[model samples]
Target: MSTTTAPEAAEAPAAPQLSHGLKQRHLSMIALGGVIGAGLFVGSGAGIAVAGPGIILAFVAAGLLVMLIMRMLGEMSAAHPASGSFSVHAEREIGPWAGLTTGWLYWVMIGVAVAVEATAAGAIMHSWVTGVPAFVWVGIFMAFFCATNLTAVKNFGEFEFWFAAIKITAIVAFLTLGVLGVTGVIGHAPGTANLTGRGGFLPHGGDGLITGLLPAVFAYGGLEAVTIAAAESDDPRRNVANAVRTAVWRIAIFYIGTMALAVTLVPWDDPDVVALGPYVTVLQLLNVPGAALAMKIVVLIALLSAMNANIYSASRMVYSLVTRGLGPRALAKVTGGVPRLSVLASCGFGFAAVLAGYIWPDTIFLWLLNSTGVAILVLWLFIGAAQLRMRRRVERENPDLLTVRMWAFPYLTWLAIAAVVALLALMTTSADNRAQLYAAGVLVTALGAVGLWHQRCTAATAATAQEPGRTP
Candidate 1:
């Protein structure tokens, strides 16, 4: 009998393989778009409802956490860029299961978000044109974005650049107008009384501020999209590092600063804030004629912009998963450096979800949204874990490759995990969010089952081949 030992594998580095057509400006705007979504334009109402004038604190706290998460992600992404971003990091540092779970969860999240954004745009359009149904508008939006994403990657970046530019312009304009109004330069100079007068700034108490953090965190959900987009950008490492480094200041100015000016210009509990819309409320107070109408256009653009980005993200994520042999291989095919089949398949799902909502008219969208609620959090958790593992390996292997390291090393990584756990706990406390916790559990179980099944099949195949005295 001859005993053979397993041979040691060569330690050859894998070559990087991602298309790079995205320019610097496109990368910057993609980062900007990720931070500024329909959440800031429309969903801010929900946070305002809970926190009153203290929502500013909620935004600030959430922004800090998001900054920490982005930094960690940046460190890993800069060190080894991948189309799957953090998921690829998970596969390298943790295991294939981690990558599979995080990648599919994020893909589902983006798909559902596409439906949500389309429905939002549909609702707005239905308001203006009473004859058309909301689902019809959703259909139109799905088709529009489907075509956009099915084209080259540059086309998608171009569209998002304009979308983000509009949102950025609107926020800056809002802030400028706000300062003018507060200083008695533009309108009646509402002053800071709106902040102090209405329930003394902390109107709803600390609980309100805590509750407000939920939606505020949601507002920062899309910032990770920038890292994914970096996979297709020129100089992805530098672009991702720059974007993550500057994310904090941009979010502070756009979200916290804008919300501060909003509450300062008008009372948190003002009827206009609740009824007319936050942006419109401030504009109306400034006696800006046709301002409400103008903002309606801006909000529409915001919704469309979100829809476009969501479709692009979902397609690319699915493409990455397919290439890893976790999904259908057809989705991995790229023509003109674009995942055409994946784009079609993703948009098909979006269209189907929208149609189901239209036909059921009862619980489709709600279920979709709840199912994807904890997914972003799941992605962040994986990112934190992957970064923790990968950073150590990178240090051991190549200590000099530390251009964009996370601050505080293992401590900050653990802190991020703790924060994610707390957020999950908080989700259980709310009736509206409790469903998400349940959905997350079910998703985890499903992913585990699939992974185990795949492992068993692979093992069986190897065993059968070995029995036949053939190589597996």
Candidate 2:
């Protein structure tokens, strides 16, 4: 079916105009920094504990998956850039239901991520200044980012660019230090002792490697922020294409390289790997001065960067949904070429989530986190599915739009889908992951049903208006 005349596409009003304020440099930095979230700093301990040195393999696998998903997403976004990104593509290719399901799922995921990132940053700051409360810090950080997002799109882009530059510089420096330490330049090289020893690198065996993949995959969650931001860039196609091309090296150096170094410099099973995190553990081993304080600052910056980016992406996504009639029309309003109302709505939800952590940490907050746990995977599935269908349609109707083509077309697309499905099925075997999958399934199903109902109602209304009128 031609997207130009699809009923689902026609049901929504025309997209609202947004500022093309994001520059090529901003897009590049966002893509580079998006992959290096606080999760890499704090959460990788579990993967290292479980997979040992083989955590490298787990990260590589996850990184490859992200790279593939980004390529597919970039292809679509380059062809037809929109704030909705994959959600818009899904609605055009699959139907209104797919769009609504994926859009809201992604929006909710980022909203929760905003709260999580804010809380993590607050905890770190409170540790530095014991007199100040963590909640107060969270409020301060929240307000600061919110103010940045509420203004022109350029402010948001500028904030993310510098935030990303900090993280990129830190990781590159860390990697350089790690290579030097491993090469016997700075210190005696362990020489595969960490990898060969400690249960011969396999440690807990294949099951451990599989278990490690869970965290490793989740660490790549925010990479899609670049594509979402691409729509507002000065040159959407060129910027998205460049960003997607660089994703390979970014993931290679920032994630895979760092994991290799962490396991190489220090024992993967080191208690401090879990106690102080992989970065701090490796830095302390290398005798870097003030390693602990240094990593704390870097990790704090990471959390803040993620908080800022997720807020921008989530607001744009909700704004896109409203423009498509999937959400409240009021949120579709744009002031100064920025979706001010949608920005507030996104920030408000994140703030409410922070309060939920205080009021009902175990019940409400935990549920919010878990329910959105599998959202990234779900969105990946939607992207794959939409790309498979949209690719064929675009080729038939407008071959010129295939600037950033998916490698190997249907084959790689199918492979990604299968990999995701296999992982989702495997997740059901684990008790904790099973709960998350169940909650996510519930959320997707409810949204899908609502979307379908709305689609049918809109069709009926359009039909009635087209019928012959007795008054006329």
lDDT of every model, 2 decimals: 0.79, 0.87
* Displacement of the residue 346 alpha carbon in candidate 2, Å: 0.3
Span of 10 residues, lowest total lDDT, candidate 2: 1-10
Error of 2 at 152 (Å): 1.1
Clashing pairs in 2: none
The CA lDDT at 471 in model 2 is 29
- Maximum-TM-score candidate: 2
Provide the lowest-lDDT 10-residue window in model 1: 1-10
Please provide TM-scores, in order, for all candidate models, with all chains considered together.
Answer: 0.92, 0.97
Q: List the residue pairs that clash in candidate 1.
A: none
lDDT value, residue 289 of candidate 2: 97
Across residues 347-422, which tens digit of lDDT does each residue of candidate 1 receive? Answer: 9888777776677656866666777887878888888988887788779888666679899989988998899889
Model 2 RMSD to the real structure? 1.9
Candidate 1 TM-score, C-alpha based: 0.92
Best by lDDT: 2
